[model samples]
Target: MASAESASLGRKVRTAARWSLVNTVVLRLGNFATGIVLARFALGPAEWGVYGVAQTVLMVLLSANELGVGLAVVRWEGDLRRFAPTVQTLSTLSSGLLYLVLFAAAPALADALGSPSASWVLRVMCVSVVLDGLAQVPNGVITREFAQIRRLVLDSVNFGISTGVTLGLAFAGWGAMSFAVGALAGNAASLLGAVIAAPGAFRFGWNRAEAGALLRFGLPLAGASLLALGVVNVDTLIVGATLGKVALGYYVLAFNMSGWPVRVVSEAARRVSFAGFSRLAESAGPALADGFSRALRVLVTGTVPMCVLLAGLAAPVVGLVYGHEWLPAARALPWLMALGLTRIGCELAYDCLVAIGARHALLAVQGLWLAALIPTLFGGARLDGIAGVSAGHALVAAGLVVPAFLLALRRGGIGVRVVARACAWPFLAGAAMAAVLVGLPRALGHSLLALAAASAGALAVYALGVLPTRHALLGVEPRHGRHARPRALLPGPSRPPVPPPRHSSESDPEPLLDGTGADGVRP
Candidate 1:
């Protein structure tokens, strides 16, 4: 009976991870398409920069408001349905409070940043945050229930509707306000979708037992989130302060362009990985190690070449995507790509560590890195403008790699040397592809046709090179584990049925990493 249960749980995790990954990727791609259009037609660099700052501020505040309740809810090993109302009430109240705080402080915040216009932007964005917060707990419940496709559809519909609305406003020359409009539209759509698909009322239950238990777990998670966000956004804040709105706009453009590649790949990986690791953590040491190893391989193999390709193709890509006036972004691309790659490394370690019940370790590492990041950001922004921001990011990336490797080694018993060995081939292959792309274009006089052919050829070569290397690193083709694969979703050869580990305790362990031996996996 125990073995059968474990097997069933493992299969469920595998299936959920795959679907979640697909849904995330599809959603991101849809957003990406709309973003490209918006970036090109709807907003110029300065307007885009303002939009970026507004959006970034809203995101930071949103993260603060949720205060890690979603993770706690996921970590809740008890009855998810029973916990749902409490989570909903808590999240809604917290968000409402945050909205009040943001609105009260908006004028002062705008003055502090020397941008009076920010007050209006901040006020508009606060509305979205509140609505966004209302959805978090219900979203968490849906995720816990393994309803990823529904989540995906909700996200798609929200973004699709918002994009359409925002584009119409942009065509009418609504400028920076267009972004705020789109964000409001998107949040409203998201709230509506959450209500329809996963209905839950937000009564202030204030269940002391439930709220207290969640807070104990959630506060640390919240701290970790704040530290991480602070590190990531300090550059923007500093750039905005030191460079002013117009220059900050350019810097943000570069920053966003640089981060997009990593976002594309990591976003999908994270959704699947969090749930999958939670499920696998219940198994024994060897099984956990195997899962960790596979996850790392997937992250590195996907992220490294993307960084390399983006770095190499930075100029052309910027021209193609955002037009010629935004050429400054290219200067930051290589550094940003490098930063993106290290971020992928750190994230892999983070997911594995978190899944294996190392929340304290996760918080500590994130704090240390954020501490290191502060001076790097301020000094870099002051020194060389936007490029300085990239320089700081690069420095942080370089510093973070060793620590991440060590943590993965310490927590999961993954060897540093083994990681280095696995990374070697992919790094080499990426470098080779970069060289070919760079050399071929110049040699052929760099026509658009020539560049296209060279880029295509380089991609083909890189793909061929990574295929064998990936197999060696992961012990199988990654396509085998891809969430979108029908065979993978079905029971198949790679997914041989394995028995669940036996348990004779008072309760089954929660499947996710929850600072305990929980046997349940929440996405």
Candidate 2:
């Protein structure tokens, strides 16, 4: 029985990872393509700068709206339906209030950001806060249920509509307003889609005890998120204020392009892992540690090569995709891309901490990261400008955040050695790929065809280098061997079987929140 359950959970994790990967790739590719069009044809440095500053402000303020409540819903072990209304109500009230505050303070924020046009843009974009807040309840429902297909469908629809509208407006010469409008439209579409797909009673309700429980759980996570937000955006803010909007535009563009692999692959894995780990914790199974190890192995293996390629091809990629005008961004791309490798592991550790209800530990780690990040970013910006900022970011990520994450992992019962072992092959593979990319002839012109061919060759080399470790990468051998029965990463007595719940036609049945549903695994 224990073996069967372990196999079942493993299958579910794999399924979730597969669909999550698909969703992330589709969404990120579409966004990247659309951004290319906007950057190359529709917007210039000044316009993009203004938009970037406003978007950064919006993102910081938007963190308040999130407050980790949605994540709380996913992590909660009891009846999620019972907590839905309270979460929805609180989110709505908080978002509405925050938007109002932002509306009034928009002018000051714009002045501080050194972009007067950003004031109105910020106000216009505030509508998305409320829209996103309302959507979180349904979004949480889908995520908690591991309904990846529904999430993919909803996000695809949202992206299609939003990108179409943004491109149309940009072509019409709306400038930064296009971004605000597109964002608002996307949020609206996502909310509608989420509500329709994940049907639930999401209404205003006040449950004092439930709300307290949620706040207690979510507040520390929120602090951690805020600290993270500050770390991410502070450099952009500094660049904008000190170096001017055009320079800031270049920096933002570089940062985005460099961080693409992390956003696409690492984030996908984190989302799925969080859901899977939450379920595993509820089951009190040793798979929590095993899942963490395997997920880290796969995430590192998958992301390292992509990051290496991005760093190696930074020049041609920027020239070809975003045009030569944006080539200055390439200078910062390599360092930022290197920084992304560290981020993959840190993200996994943070998710593991959250899954196990170690919010305070997560908070402490984020605080330490912020302590190292701010001074480094400021000094870097002052010393070498944007490149310095990127270098500083890379240094801090490797020196501080990575170590902090390993400590958090240890606190969560995962050993640093486990992660190190998982990382060894990927690092070697990535190093080989980087060497090939750097050593190869620079005779190729900066064209899409040239870049494509080079990327293919680099990927081939990486594949060959890592080929012998295929079983580990694919999770085929588990901790033993191919034919051995799967065992948990940590030794423990098997959990007693949980009795099946009784159901009646008269009483509406609640679906099991065991990361599965009647159809199969929910993912």
Candidate 3:
């Protein structure tokens, strides 16, 4: 019975992962294209710098905006209808309070981040927090049920509306405020879609006991998530404060450019990772460790070439995509690329930890990261400007934080040996790919065709190098001299059919909350 249940949920997880990957890839590509247009004509570095500050603030706020109760919709057994009203109430109230605080303190906060001019932008853009709060219940329903197809349609609407509005306003000379307004419109679309996906999901009901249980369960998770987000966003603050807005702008561009693989692969995986891992934890089987190793291997293998090539081809990519004026961003891109690769592994580990109720451990690792980051980041900016900061950020993530996380995972039975094994092949392939890209002659012109050809060549080498990951990607455990098909993707002839998932008398518990369903499109 237990094996059957795992198999059923495994099917759902794989199917959800497929759709989620599609959703993230499509939206990221759309956002990337829109960003190119904006960078080329609509906005310059200073404007982008201010927008980046506002964006950083929004991401940080959104991480804790709901106080983390929304995930309860995914993890708890029994009828969601019993406690969903309270979840909505708690989410809405918390977000409303947070927005109010930000509204009153925007100027001071913007100034602290070295962007006083962005005070208004921060105020306007953070309105989505309240909208996110109101919609968390419905969105949680969507995630719990692995409803990525619905999410895709909804997020597409958000992308179209946001992109159209931002472009129109930028052309009309609204500056950074254009991004804020456009984001507001986009979040509204997200809310509407969430409601449509799960009707009557946003109701206000307060059960003191239920609310207490939720807070008990959620606060630690929220704190951990906030710290995790801080580990990523605090650099923007440090950059803006230690350097100037223009330097901050360069760093932001470089960092975002480096995030291509992390966003596309990690975002999609995380949308379902917590819920899936939570289910796996309940089974208390070796499946969690096995699944973790496989997922980590796949992510590292797929992400390696992208990160390596982006780092190697940073100069051409920034030059061709954002124009010659933005070439300075290239210097910081390689270091940020390393950071992006580290984040993919760490984030997957984070979801696994969160699912197994390892919130304290998460808080410790993330807090240590943020605590270490402030000094390193500031010192780096004082040394080599944005590039130094990027190098410093990557250093902390790989050197300090990655080891810390591995220890925590080791405590959870996912040994360092497992991680090392998973990472060994991908890391070797990435290094080889990097060598090829870095060794390439500078004779290649800065044209699109030239960049594409170089990237294709580097990636082809990477593909061949990581050919052993093929079985893993297909969801089969790889063992030497034991080649077998992945039953997850294509079950064998004699394998029993996975049993259908049984619904509770009250509701199906299938989805979880992602911190950014506060809607994570950067400005």
Model 2, span 210-284: residue lDDT tens: 787667666676677667667767778888888788888898889878767886777567556776666565455
Worst 10-residue lDDT window, candidate 3: 504-513
**Top candidate, metric TM-score:** 3
* Top-scoring candidate (lDDT): 3
Identify the runs in model 3 with alpha carbons over 4 angstroms from their true place: 442-453, 477-483, 489-523
Q: Which prediction has more favorable lDDT, 1 or 2?
A: 2
lDDT of 3 by residue, 397-461 (tens): 99999999999998887899889988998898888877766665456765677667767778888
* Model 3 error, position 232 (Å): 0.8
Look at candidate 1 and tell me the lDDT of residue 465: 74
lDDT of each candidate versus the true structure: 0.64, 0.71, 0.79
Each candidate structure's TM-score, on Cα atoms with residue i matched to residue i, is: 0.86, 0.89, 0.92
Q: How many clashing pairs in candidate 3?
A: 3
Which is the better candidate, 1 or 3, if ranked by lDDT?
A: 3
Candidate 3 achieves a global lDDT of: 0.79
On lDDT, the stronger of 2 and 3 is 3
- Candidate 1 lDDT, 81-123, residue by residue in tens: 5555666677678878988988998888766654567778778
Model 3, position 344: C-alpha lDDT score = 90
